[model samples]
Target: MSPQEKTPATLPWLTDEFLQKILRDAGGHETTVVTSSDIKPMAGGGDNYLSTMYRVSVKTKDKEEAVSTISLVVKLPPSGAEMMKLIANSSAFLTEIKLLSDILPKMFSLLRETSPEEQEEFGAKCFYAKNTMPYVLIMEDLASKGFRMAERQKGLDLRHSIVVMRSLARYHATAIALHKRDPALVESFEENFYTDSRGFVSNATLPMLRSLAEVVRSWPGFGDDYRGRLLKRADTIYDDVMELMKPEGNAFNVLNHGDLWVNNMLFRYEEVTGEVRDVKFVDFQLCRYMSPGIDLQYFIHTSVAEEIRAERVGDLLREYHKTLCATLEDLRCADSIITFQELVDEYERKALFGFFVTTMILPILLSDPDTIFNPEQSHQKEDEAIVTKRISNIHFTTVLKRLLPIYAKKNFF
Candidate 1:
């Protein structure tokens, strides 16, 4: 096929016309000419499982001969037709597209009205978004602006965690304020990782539990009874998880960045001092309206470095709650702030969810990044060697050893 004839399979929304439109939108340029455009697909793993990102570098010149390079990222549903169909049927990607375009703007406007001078930008600037099938998102390239992801294996430390928690506090607080303004605004954010039409999570979690139980059984200290308890929990795991996400007894709730792990967040550091400057959250595809505790517990355990997590967990939660109350006060939602005791109670209730999530992702995170695992088929492939191998990997083994005992004492597993 001719270069002009090639289609990015109903995707590749970055066409000549789109290039002109986004440029006009991004820079407010009256007229711009695209001299050349280079599009490169992002490498797999770490970002999330639901979409693909393409980095587009466009060289443009105006009528005045002033030239500039515009760096953008184009995000699309999975390239596989089956995976695309599944996500398209669910509200995951649709929720994110709508969020970046419509909802986050309202939230940001609240921030501007309340605390403009203090907070940095909340997320990547969206130049354009289309919510229909094979949806597309075009936003500024964060990396070009000096943002980099924290090393997933190494994890975030105290300073990094403080910055991140502050951002999350602002995010959840703004969401609560917005929700109070319009109750229906959050109706669309009700679906999450388990809402796949094909029962993927149910299929995937059971096998993962069985595998985890087997490995624990092989460990030096854990006995058969421990394995039995682990396996027994699998019987009601899905229902148990879904229940935690629902509003609990009039407790405060806000939207959750459902997959809140290290890879989904990015940090920018000061150029001279190397101190962390700000935080930005990406990948809201799995977001749902749930307790902020879910995000807190998951981030504390799975993303923070172990020593910091052990020594300063209380300090971290205090930072989050203090910021939460402060931001709520800015928005006049101080009445919505949970008490310190209540915050700790809520986080403890959601701690099991964090454990399950950490157990669920550790293998994938520890595995070779070169090997991309497909979430769509992960459920039915019980016999796959990667699952077993990753379960037994020494890195995974060490984490599970510490994790299972800790969670078990809390009656989480």
Candidate 2:
């Protein structure tokens, strides 16, 4: 088939007309062009399992220059009607579309106007989205800019954690500044999963909690008392988790990159020194307005290694608070509204937020793709059994042994 003849089935919302428009806008010229062959699927991390990603390379020729190539990453909702329906019913795709199309740009624009010096340092530049069904988002491909994903199994060390925390601070600070400048925009971020109870009661919730309980039961030193406590807690995990998800109604509230983890962030390193320098976050499907503690706890729990977390979680939280204060000051907001102590206290109170989230995703993070059960195939009885079995993989036991004690000591359980 010719390039112009490619249908939505092949490229979703991508069409020759939309391609030309994207190229022209990106290049700031009208002569840009591309072909179907220039678009190809790109390998993304686990978060991308719910969506489709593509790298589009277009050759553009200005009136006075030779042809040059422009690259963009196109993200679309999952193709299956059932999957799309589920996503639509939840806050997933709509939250992401609003974030990339509305909130981020407004925040960046405000940053440029108020804090021009730091404006260019934060966030990725997303291209305009058509914002129709099957939701397409075009953005600059970070890979072309030397950004790479951190390895999931290895987890992040102190330096990598610092980079992500600093970036996250800036992102959260922007939301605060945006709230100050445009409360309506920040208020609109309330349309997320946390605002509703349906997400906590989803089919995956009970099974995940049971798997977590089983892992706890299988731990070597786990006493019967603790195991019973964990199982009883599992029965109420959804309600407890929902309570943590509720808004704190404080000055510290900001828009969170609801799904913060190793896979959701990308980093650029210094070539010679091997030093981590820059970080950018992706996957805003779960973005929400909540206490910044939610993002902090979730990222540290799921992405940082247990050893690093054991020794340096306190330092890491301080570093994040430091950046958050500095960024808020830069944005002309009150840095003292949420003190460092308040942050620590908030984290302590909301620590179960991380525990619950970690239980759901840690197994997936540690498991290999071949061994992991396919969610799409779960309709089959055999596939359902496979998925149930895989959920109690040995990695869960290891993670539970390492983390449960810490959670208990902190009263997170």
Candidate 3:
């Protein structure tokens, strides 16, 4: 039978029986019988490389009139065998399952206890999750609630950037509070995508760096010597990248939203002025315990426009540090672990990280879905070639050209 024609196995969490139980539990009415219908695929952000998402409409009632109708987004592992193999080889899927199922709830509960008045400002809530393979995470549909994704090509403007920075600060501070209250709980969080050698991102680093080196060789002013130096450096790029991801002396470490580009965040805007009011982060597959600079630098490089990054990066960092300090203070955690100066210093130390990740991800972020390869539609061999070509497109080259000199000037290479 063709791959499409073969009946796909139903994941345990996707069954109607499971949905009824969770829906009733969420509504706080155990006897309510929930019926789900119109299950359809949701267009996901390009970052969800190893999974697919579905929007499910659920009607809940207790043998009478409908009590309420709810929409939920269900994330499931990739169904294609090749894609499933990649996910199985990496830590991303399991890490996210643990994050949503175990860590986030505990962190949210602790935050509520420490700052009851501000409890509402915590992270996104997962309605239900099953950590086993054929993993599933059901979360409130942020899009239905008026949260929209930022444009990947245009990137985030100053106001949106501020909202996201504030949210990230609150998120990082929660980890700090949790660590202080119960160190053992956060012990396992240290092994993130970068730290795990078997993870997809870590394995992709060398090839991506080599691709960057190839791009550099074709630049106008670059010659053999420059290309040689870059190629030599590329040989050690993976190890260097991994080292940068490590926390330095217990100073500025926190549980970082390991992937923090524009596509991973959703913002709700004020309808009148079109100003950003609140933000929600999604796709925790890469969440890790690392220095805050990992997320900070990643977002700046991948999501902010060049002019905004060059002109206001210092201001943005200051804003992030201020919010982080306030959050830590509110949570009653030690605020002196890292000063603003130290944060800046750490950001500078890890500047190369932004360059590396941007080169690897910006193409996928900027390209349209039609232009990119779809593993579900294409053969594995053809998809590999298409992905390589997609990453080397004009959008990727343009951003690389814009960023190369900045990295050189900063001595980040």
lDDT for each of the candidates? 0.78, 0.71, 0.72
Highest-scoring model, TM-score? 1
- When superposed on Cα atoms, how far off is each prediction in RMSD? 2.3, 2.9, 3.9
Can you give the lDDT of residue 13 in candidate 1? 48
Candidate 2 achieves a global lDDT of 0.71
TM, every model = 0.93, 0.89, 0.87
By summed lDDT, which 10 consecutive residues of candidate 1 come out lowest?
1-10
Looking at model 1, residue 282 earns an lDDT score of 86
lDDT of 3 by residue, 161-247 (tens): 888888888888888888877776665666665565343454444445555566567678765655576667666667777788876
Instruction: For candidate 1, list the clashing residue pairs, or say none.
Output: none
Which ranges in model 2 have alpha carbons more than 4 Å from their true place? 4-8, 35-37, 44-47, 116-118, 194-201, 377-396, 409-413
Best by lDDT: 1
Q: Write down the TM-score for model 3.
A: 0.87
> Model 3, poorest ten-residue lDDT window?
1-10
Question: Sort by lDDT, best first: what order?
Answer: 1, 3, 2
